[model samples]
Target: MQREDALRSIDVAVLAGGLGTRIRGVLGDTPKVLAPVAGRAFLAHLLDYLARHGAQRAVLCLGHLADRVTAWLAQGDSHHAIDVVCQVEPRPLGTAGALRFVRGELRTAHVLVVNGDTFLDADLRAFVASHRLSGAEASVLCVEVEDATRFGRVEIGADGRVLRFAEKSPGPGTINAGVYLFSAAFLDRVAASDAASLERDVLERLPPGMLHAVVTRARFVDIGTPESLAAAAEVIGEGTP
Candidate 1:
């Protein structure tokens, strides 16, 4: 498929349901996605990025403070016309569970899932093409960091398939950038529980060859903590991926 067509074919899901415990002190009661960054809500930049890449639709899976996100969306804060929708998790469902909760709303064979609090400046078109070419059930975007101490490491085999994941340690290594393209079948395999973690419960259990790695040397930022959140404005400037 053509790059634009391929991008439009998949529904994008921004996983924004976490409790934001790490950054709670900095942002009181506000959902992490709604936290101010570079004078605008973080979700605004994310939706614009998707729209720039030709993503037609997006579902913001929200929890913790779903009303805050919904209220923000209601005020016409988003400038992009990317057909945004909100799915509030009845409770605190983990990443995988949150996706499962809104699986029926996603109207595509494949879904691009991203963390609302993180940004990776990589080509969405290229990632989609690579995922289709690999034929794996799922593909994860892996980026090399100078210090992978905070984020655990992702091991990829010579064949470009994920071998296994290693615990966080001090050193330069490739880590999961929290961006994923998953087939509908892959999302279906998540358990029916409300608290299953995407990393611990689903991803780590997958076989070596089942997950493909789309490695990129792009700028990656995780705004899950106060320090990282403060630095995000510089990493993800206006219109950055």
Candidate 2:
């Protein structure tokens, strides 16, 4: 699709509500999305990336210290067209539950979902296009990591459809890169009354041969811990993938 067409086609929903328990000490008092990396709020970098990739409208799912997140984003005027949606979970409602909270705000047939803590240099436009072309209900952006044991590994079929999703296993396989392209139909499947996890509740519940995984040639970084945060800062500073 053309750039303009793509820009008008997709809406982005960033999962920024996490408590960031792992990085709280280093980030003290600031929402994890506001943590500085390469001299800018991490959320700015994420929004900039999304805007460049043709995301016309973006929503930020916020929790814990949400006001700070809003204030920070408002100050920068980053991605001027972005829309911020605050999802305050009284109790921790796993990933899918958080998503379900904002189901009504999703305006597109497909939405691009990204974890606020992980940054991956994947071609999001192509990712969405691939999903549009494929008949799968959901497509996860995956990468081959050296330590698959730390993150859940997803197995894909010869045709690029997800066959199995293994959580933090010792063996080597493709790991979820914290990004996903999901059809609007997936929203209907989310239960409204209770907290649910995307991995454990939704993904695992999908019928066999439905969920697909796409391997991307992109650099992935998880900024949830001090060490990884430093690494992301270095990568951003050096301008290297």
Candidate 3:
């Protein structure tokens, strides 16, 4: 699909509310999304990727040190037409809970949701198109990993529908790439509580055929740890696959 056409069909929601407790040793007092990678805030690189891939509007779910993020993004209109929504949780809300906070803002039949702390190279337009065509409640981006010990590993059927979500399983498996295309109907199922997890509560509870997975043939990195953050910087700096 042409970039312009894809841009018109989808909206973006970036989950940036995490406290980055795991990387605090390397990123003290800074939100994970603002950690420097390749001389720019990692969030900048994420926004650039989305914009290049035909994302016209973006909603950023902010929590920790959100004012700093807001001020920085507004410095020069660097985000183009992207919109930021502050979701100040009284206490930390898990993935799905943070999303539920802004459910009303994402008023689309399907919206693309991405983790702010990860860099993914999948063709987002193709992912969204596939989700729309498959008619599934949600479609997740999955990538094969040599070690799926630290992430949620997905088991998919021959038809590409997700069979199960195995969280942090050992051995070789396709892990969740932190990218997703969600149907609007699923958001209505999210309760107004602040302690829901997408992996444990939502995805796991879905029937076998309700969810789908798309395997990505591109490079991806989760930048939540110090070592991975360094690796992400190297990837961006070298511009190598």
RMSD to the true structure for each prediction, in A, is 1.7, 2.2, 2.2
lDDT tens digits by residue: candidate 2, 1-241? 7543554676777888888999999999998888888888888888777776667787777777888987776686474455556556666667887788777888888888889888887666667778778887788889877667778878788888878887677765688888888888776667453547787777776776788777875777888888889889765564422
- The lDDT of each candidate is 0.87, 0.77, 0.79
After TM-score superposition, what is the CA distance of residue 181 in candidate 1 from its true location, in Å? Answer: 0.7
User: Which segments of model 2 are wrong by more than 4 Å?
Assistant: 2-7, 77-80, 170-172, 191-195, 238-241
How are the candidates ranked when ordered by TM-score, highest leading? 1, 3, 2
Give RMSD (Å) of candidate 3 vs. truth. Answer: 2.2
Would you estimate the TM-scores of all the predictions? 0.95, 0.90, 0.91
lDDT of 1 by residue, 101-211 (tens): 998888899999999988888888888989989998899999999999999999999999999999999999999999999988877776354447898888888888789
Clashing pairs in 1: none
Cα lDDT for residue 69, candidate 1: 88
Per-residue lDDT for 114-135 in model 3, tens only? 9889887666767777887898
Q: Which 10-residue window in model 2 sums to the lowest lDDT?
A: 1-10
